[model samples]
Structure formats: structure tokens, C-alpha cells
Target: MRVLGVDPGLTRCGVGVVEGTPGRPCTLVAVGVIRTDPDAPLPDRLLRLDTKLTEYIARFAPDAVAVERVFSQHNVASVIGTAQASGVAILAGARADVAVHTYTPSEVKAAITGSGTADKKQMTSMVTRLLRLEVAPKPADAADALALAICHVWRGGTQARIAAARTRVEEKGTRT
Candidate 1:
């Protein structure tokens, strides 16, 4: 099963691709951040995000795209931009015929670290250990993306879980 995890922001968006079997750890296919100038016009930033996200969807060909839900800590502007960025990711996935799913920060943290109130460092550390990565996913955005991926993996989406089942079926046939 393959999933594209997205951490959306107006200035910097993070993306990750992960694949795994049912009983094994997820393998990181790719992980990185997409950045735009915060100084740029909002429309321009949105366009840039759209372009980059479409490219990512094309390159990764993910079965599903998992994005973080919008929850404002304090800044209204930041929340608005996050919603826009998330829209871009959803549109990108829609264009590619891939389904999009949204997970809350607490949900992601709980799935990855077994705690809803897990800190960034704790989430990062758990993501690293779960994926067997040598270094933590960086820039916080990327860690969040990886965490989103892990959430979807742990919760089992339709596409991802279905793909995993197919692989198991084929493996069983081969064994027989």
C-alpha cells in the first residue's frame, strides 16, 4: 500500500510517500518540504503550491493522500493559509484519481506516538523508530507529514488496506 502524506502551509508544505505490508514497518519512498515565499502574493503562493502538489501526485502515484486537519493555535491568518494549502493538496489528489483523507494533529500524534498530547519531538522520535529512519524527519513540517502517513497506515484506509490484502493474497498463492 502506498500513501502520500501532506503537511500543508502557505509558505511551506511537507510531503511524504510511504509503502508497507500489513505486519511490517512502513517504508519511506520519499519525504520533503515544498516551500513558497511568504512574501509572495497569496494567489501566487497558492498557484505555486498547486503546481508543486500536482507534480508530487504525478510522481508518487499514491493510492491515497492524507492531509492534516486545520486547527488554529492562535493565528487566524495561519489557519486560513493552512486551509488553502490543504485545498491544493486535496485538489491535486482528486485530479490524480486518488482519494484524500484528513487527520487531526491529536489523531496523528496518537496514532504515531500513542498519545494525543504528544509533543513534536516525541512524534518525531516515534516516526523515526517506526520507519527505521536514521534521522528524524526534519523541519517539523516533514515530521508532521510522516506522522500523517503513519496515522493513515495505522488506521487503515480503503485503498491502503485493500492493497495490503491483495499483496497478501498473491503471496499466499505463491506459497501454495
Candidate 2:
């Protein structure tokens, strides 16, 4: 499966695409950051982010989009911006008729590094190793985006199968 992972921020939203299945090596399709002017108006910034995310969804044609879920932060303003960006990312996937999943930061870290408390350095190192890249992706945001994609590629399939099974069971129960 191909997945597009989004680490959303108002200024520098990270985007990455990875292709693979569970328990297998994943290939990096693309990785980059979408930058918007911090000084730009809120509406303009959101529109820019939305447009870029939509373009990525079209270009990559990912089977799913894994977005970093916005969590409460000390800075309310920061959290608001991130939450808005996250919504735009999700909307992009929905507009393209692609399945969208949101994973928490801790969940991603654990999936990529086997520890929810792994630091940025460790996460970057693991992402580099897992992708078999000679060098780590530049900027913490970029690396984080790749890590998100890798996490989803490693876990999303199994989770999807489980959900499908549950739905099937529910349907059968209702019919019976």
C-alpha cells in the first residue's frame, strides 16, 4: 500500500509518501515540506496548505493518508494552527476519496523506534535506517513526516483488516 503522511503546521507542514505492506521493507516515494509565510493571513495560509496537500494527494495517489493527530500543547496558538493544518490535510485526502488516518506522536514514535518516548534524534536515526537512506531527511519536520509514513505502512494494513473483520461480524450479528 502507498501512504502519504502529513505532519501539519502552519509554517512548514511536512509531507511524505511511502509504499509497502506490513512486515516488509517500504520504499520512499517522496518527502518534502510545504512552507507558508508566517506573516500571511490565517485564511491565506490555510488555503496555501490546502492547495499543496491536494496536489500531493493527486500526485502520489496514495491508498491512504496518515496525518499526525493534533494534541494539546502548552501554547494554545500553536495548537490551533496545527489543528487547522491537520484538518486541511485530512480534507485533501477526503476530497480525493482516499482513506485518512490520524496517529498520535507517541504512537508514531513507538511504531518507528519501539519506544513512545523516543527523542527526535532517535526517531530520525531510525527513519534513516529503516528507509536505507545514506543520509537522514533534512529538517526535523521532514524526518518526522517520513517516520509517520513508515509507521502507517507498518501498522495501517493490520488495523484495517481488524476493522473490516469487526464490521463483518457486526453485520452478520444484525442479520441473525
Q: Which candidate is the best by TM-score?
A: 2
Per-model TM-score, in order, reads: 0.86, 0.91
What C-alpha lDDT does candidate 2 achieve relative to the native structure? Answer: 0.91
lDDT digits (tens) for residues 70-111 of candidate 2: 978636869888888998999989989999999999999999
lDDT (Cα atoms) of all candidates against the true structure: 0.86, 0.91
For model 1, residues 45-138, the per-residue Cα lDDT tens digits are 9999889889888888887899988876737857888888998888888888898899888888887777999998888898899899998888
Residue 144 lDDT in model 2? Answer: 89
How far is 66's C-alpha from truth in model 2 (Å)? 0.4
Error of 2 at 30 (Å): 0.3
- Which residue pairs in candidate 2 have backbone atoms (N, alpha carbon, C) closer than 3 angstroms, thus clashing? none
Worst 10-residue stretch by lDDT in candidate 2? 71-80
The 10-residue segment of model 1 with minimum total lDDT is 153-162
Candidate 1: residue pairs that collide: none
Q: What is the lDDT of residue 168 in candidate 2?
A: 100
